[model samples]
Target chain A: MPELLPFAVSLKGTENAVRDGLAQAMACLAPLHLNTDDAGTVELVLAEALNNVVEHALASTPELTAIEIRGSHGADGLHITVIDCGAPMPDGTAPLAKTPNLDVETHDMPEGGFGWYLIHTLATDVKYSRVGAANHLSLQLPVGV
Target chain B: MELTSSTEHGLQIVTVQEPRIDAAVALAFKDRMRDTTEGGIDTVVLDLNHVQFIDSSGLGAIVAAMKNLAPDRKLILAGLTPTVDKVFRLTRMDSVFGVFPTVEAALTKLRA
Candidate 1:
């Protein structure tokens, strides 16, 4: 059977939109025939990446913001690019993925800040750039290789 | 987010009925958790057997639920699927929470 070519999904910058977009994106990758573990990895990475755009990049102007997710499968893996017409990443760069301090007391445990960490840990070749009025973040998942 | 709770062996076992716990329902999940766990039970066991996927927001909501019951009550996790377990392990939150392979195991160990 012939593989599905590159796919794209456009969504609004909202939580529900991200969820629906992810579902559509996963459906598009159905042709990849990824194993269970690999499929989970792809889902996780994409969720984190898209969530960041909705939460950070589009936080200020969510109503007017839009996100685009594009993906293609290759011998290396599944490469995904998330683009948004929102604010550029702080200082025009992606935040460093630092493991939060988990040794603290239970009351002081972090309730957030794990998004980038998960993305960086699970996805490779993560790159961020500001093209004109849009922010482009791309990464590769080591699946379907 | 939909959750159901029942008392078994004096433990409040709360089960998440949804499949994906991502940013979309993280807040709702946290609120539901708080409402479901508001009682005399000091230990609550979260059964995630039906949940197949969880994002960082969901992970953070779980952590928040634990913190909301900290110092007096406790939150235990059970029946983590592969993706859910991966999130917990990658964030090192697994070490923070007492995880069991099944709700029965958690109940057995706690009841013992």
Candidate 2:
């Protein structure tokens, strides 16, 4: 089984449309026999990434900014890579650090924590990288999805 | 999604329809909660059967409702599918809100 299938979508504005792209990814991976627990894991990882675009990936620009999504799935689990043209990451918050911990809420915490935090906990591997001008986040689910 | 409420055994059950519950609907959801409760109905229950996605703010709105309606009333969450459950858990809303499996179950428990 070739472990690579790709889906790419470019969405405009910070609408709920991001969920559609993600739901597609989850739908594709569902037939691969990932049990109930891992299925929930996949859903959270994708939702958090799509959500980042809605809340933080845009600036004072017209409400026309779009999110780019590229996803793939296979026997070892599903992998969805989200590429968003949001504000430049903050230093170490860049490339890929662990999704900040949202388990403990604090006043100084930035909007960046919970999304990445849930993605990190739900997936066996979560990586964020800045490529060109986009923030690319790759989330891996263990166990062939 | 629109949130509608009704009281059963002193429990206010708020039904939320639609797939995503985020910033746009968060306020409206909260308002309906307050409005209904202020109308002499407390013990709120949010029915999330139709809600497939919920963000931090959405989760926050629910939490806010709890704080705003405490003592006199409390918010209970019901029908959280796996996706919504994960959001609630990751955000720790699950800890703050009393979660139930169904609206009927929530009503029963709240009344007890």
Candidate 3:
């Protein structure tokens, strides 16, 4: 199959923005006709990645925060790069994708800290970088190959 | 964040009427769950058949809901779609809850 043109979606750094951006990104992938599982994987990974930007990277920025998502499908898989004009990751690195401990007591169970884990588990080649004034996250979802 | 509840056979069934339970509504969903399941039956079944998508935040809210009813009441999960099931299985949270294929199946097994 021929290569599809890369699609980019610009969004604000907000929860509702993430939701709307995800819907548009998924719609852009419709041409690939990805299976249900693949579609879901793409959507979930994007949601987590974008949420990280809105909640963490852009947390302190009260000014207008801009987030851009670019995606392209190829033989290897779907390549996604999320760019944001926000604070660089702490220590200039992304947090390790460690799965939260589920062995704790019921009341002590973790209610958060699963975003990066899900992104790492479902997506491959996860990379994070600080480019000047922006944070760039790129990953590959093994779908539509 | 529309949740409908009904009680049957001494079990409270709470159904999520929305298509998603992501960050956009995670907190609201959690708060609504606390209100809906407050002082209900000992066992609560959350129906997720209509929900096609769930992110980590949404998963966290569900976990919070279950924890909110801890040591007294219990929260069970039913009608998980494939995508939602994938999240639970990947996170290994499926082991933490009594997951059923459908609400009917959950009610049958829980009633027995």
TM-scores for every candidate against the unseen true structure: 0.97, 0.79, 0.98
* lDDT of each residue in A110-136, candidate 2, tens digit only: 333465656666677777778888788
**In candidate 3, how many Å is residue B94 off?**
0.3
Model 2 accuracy (lDDT, Cα): 0.67
Best by lDDT: 3
Off by over 4 Å in 1: none
Q: Which ten residues in a row have the lowest lDDT in candidate 3 chain A?
A: A57-66
In model 3, where do residues sit more than 4 Å from their true spots? none
lDDT per residue, candidate 2, B37-90, as tens digits?
685645778789998767656776676677677666667889998778877776
**Model 1 residue B102 lDDT score:** 99
In CAPRI terms, model 3 is classed as: high
The Cα error of candidate 1 at residue A96, in Å, is: 1.2
lDDT of 3 by residue, A1-145 (tens): 6466899999889999888999999989988888899999999999999999988888887248889999988888999999998888888877888988999999988889999899989998899998888889999999988
Candidate 1 per-residue C-alpha lDDT over A1-145 given as tens digits, one digit per residue, 9 for 90 to 100:
3276999999999989988898899999998887778889989999999888888889988879789999987878889999999888878788889998999999999999998899999998899999999899999887887
Best candidate, TM-score: 3
Q: What is the lDDT of residue A86 in candidate 1?
A: 88
- Global CA lDDT computed for model 1: 0.91
Worst 10 residues of 1 chain B by lDDT: B34-43
Clash count of each predicted structure:
0, 6, 0
